[model samples]
Target chain A: MRELEERIRREGRVLGTDVLKVDNFLNHQVDPKLMVALGHEFAMRFADAGVTKVLTVESSGIAPAVFTALDLDVPMVFARKRKSITLSADNYTADVYSFTKQETNHIIVDKRFIQPKDSVLIIDDFLANGQAAQGMMEIITAAGANLVGAGIVIEKTFQKGRQLLNEANVRVESLARIEDFVNGQVVFANED
Target chain B: MRELEERIRREGRVLGTDVLKVDNFLNHQVDPKLMVALGHEFAMRFADAGVTKVLTVESSGIAPAVFTALDLDVPMVFARKRKSITLSADNYTADVYSFTKQETNHIIVDKRFIQPKDSVLIIDDFLANGQAAQGMMEIITAAGANLVGAGIVIEKTFQKGRQLLNEANVRVESLARIEDFVNGQVVFANED
Candidate 1:
């Protein structure tokens, strides 16, 4: 967690008040070594939860989810944003509001992949508005799978995402929680 | 490669003429153990290529790309399908035609992540018509990066993907190459 926090402080770009760009090592371009360490940290944090699967929505979340799945030795399932012809007709879907895109899109998963009794851990790169995490939880709930908790690499604590997830009674763990960003400088929540 | 071949023969489902579904293990829902094995195989194949980065187009390709990056101990860069606020304005963009979706989509990568001197290895979940791979190649070319080769988990030999890549003079290594699907069974090409 310290390593993540340090890397975030070093490589992460604080843009304005809300946006934090970590494309160098977190999302677009992934550092596998850092990813593996983060995976271990998540596993250590959720060691007792009996997580059978790791669920995440595509593109950014896939790398961390894969590493977390490897650490947990469980299967990793990613919800596809676009419905391809190859996907099965039977699927569990939920609409996710994208704060960045300013639109809602449906994220879907094959019903066959998620069993009724599976315990799932949701992982993602960023937790801003918590819309993507909420959508994933909806799909998991629809499939009758038990939601263990959600793990995030970076979180904007000033946002209402944490409050929303907490209201849903979802336990959330983020490696680096941002308290605020002022004049291109990040203020960690724990610092104060 | 035998493990991968066995996985394909056992868990892979053939739908109609060309659609092969391995959602239980490969793309949608990933088996991390198998993915690690596949990663080792890719590392072995492209060991001498001096790959500085592993590149893949997002969604399904992320898992394999992550594992491949882990095996090679290099960073992985995934080209995003949709444009986001986090994406930089300066990018190397390529139009990819999806056979399954029946539409062409633009895949973009931040130009800064991939440098001119970087040697990249493209990894993907499946290689069908090679459109996705071609799109990735275009990005690499645009960035002035050298593409070492491509590693695919499953390749449909019946399709023109292999031939197209061959014509482009790009080396491709696939764990399981499907000769054909007969009576819902996958028949792989004989190993040379």
Candidate 2:
């Protein structure tokens, strides 16, 4: 977590009070070493959860989720943003609203991938309002699978995402929790 | 390569003459162990290429690209299909036609991630017509970076993707090349 916080401090760019741009290393352009370390950290935090699969959305979430799955020695299931031609007809679908895109898109996971006997750990690169995480949980529930917990790399603590997940009774672990952003400085939740 | 070929034969589904879906272990639900192995194979193939960065497109390409980057001990950059708030305004953009969706989407790569001295190896899940690879190459060219070659997990030998890359003077290595799909059987080009 210290490494993640330090990397964020050095590379993260804050715009206004709401957004943290980490495209340089976390999402658009990924640092594989950091990715492996983040995976180790997530696996360590959720080592006892008996996670069977790591679930995430498409695009940004795949890298960290793949690394986490590798560390946990499990498979990762990424929900596609849209149903493509190659995606099978048998799928558990859920609609998620993207505030960035300003539209609702349907995401899907094959029903056969998640089984009732499996326990899933939801993972993502960023958690702002928690809509994507909620959508993934719905897919897991649809497959009759158990969601042991949620793991996120960076979280905006000022938002209600953590509160929402906690109210849903899901144990959550985030490497970097942002407390607030003032002017150009980003304040971590645990920082004085 | 044998492991990948076995996986494709066992889990890959033939949708028709043109599409082979490997969502079970390659794209949608990814097997991390297999992913690591495939990454190792690609790294071995391009070991002497002096690959400083791994380039790919968003969504499905991120997983293998991440693993390849990890194996090569380099960073990976994925082009965004859509403009998001987090992506920096300074980027190199290209237009790619998606035959699956029947539309052209603009992909962007942050200019700062690629340097003129960088040697990039483009990585992707599938290579059919090779438009995605070409688009990625355009970004690399815009940055004045050298594209060492491309590493593809699956290639449709029946298609012109390989020919297109070869014509562009870009080297390509595809782990599994499908010659045809006849009566629900996959025919690899290398199989007798």
Steric clashes per prediction: 0, 0
DockQ per model, Cα: 0.83, 0.87
Task: For each candidate in the order shown, give its overall lDDT on alpha carbons.
Answer: 0.88, 0.90
- Measured with C-alpha atoms, the lDDT of residue A62 in candidate 1 is 81
True contacts kept of each: 0.94, 0.97
Model 1 chain B weakest 10-residue run by lDDT: B80-89
lDDT score at residue A129, model 1, on the 0-100 scale: 87
Evaluated on CA atoms against the true complex, candidate 1 attains a DockQ of: 0.83
Query: lDDT per residue, candidate 2, A20-119, as tens digits?
Result: 9998999888999999999999999999999999999998888889889999999999998873334456988887877876878888888889999999
Give the residue spans of candidate 1 off by over 4 A. A83-89, B83-89
State the lDDT of candidate 1 residue by residue for A1-192, as single tens digits: 789888988998877678889999978999988988888888889889999999998878887888888999999999988533344469988888888868778899899877899999999988888899999999899899999999998889988889999999999999999989978988888996
The estimated TM-scores of all candidates read 0.95, 0.96
Judged by DockQ, which candidate is best? 2
lDDT of 1 by residue, B1-192 (tens): 789888888888899988998989988898988888888899989999999999998878888888889889899999988532344568888888888978788899899889999999999999899999999999899889999999999999989999999999999999889988889988889843
Candidate 2 residue lDDT tens string, B69-89: 999999999998863334456
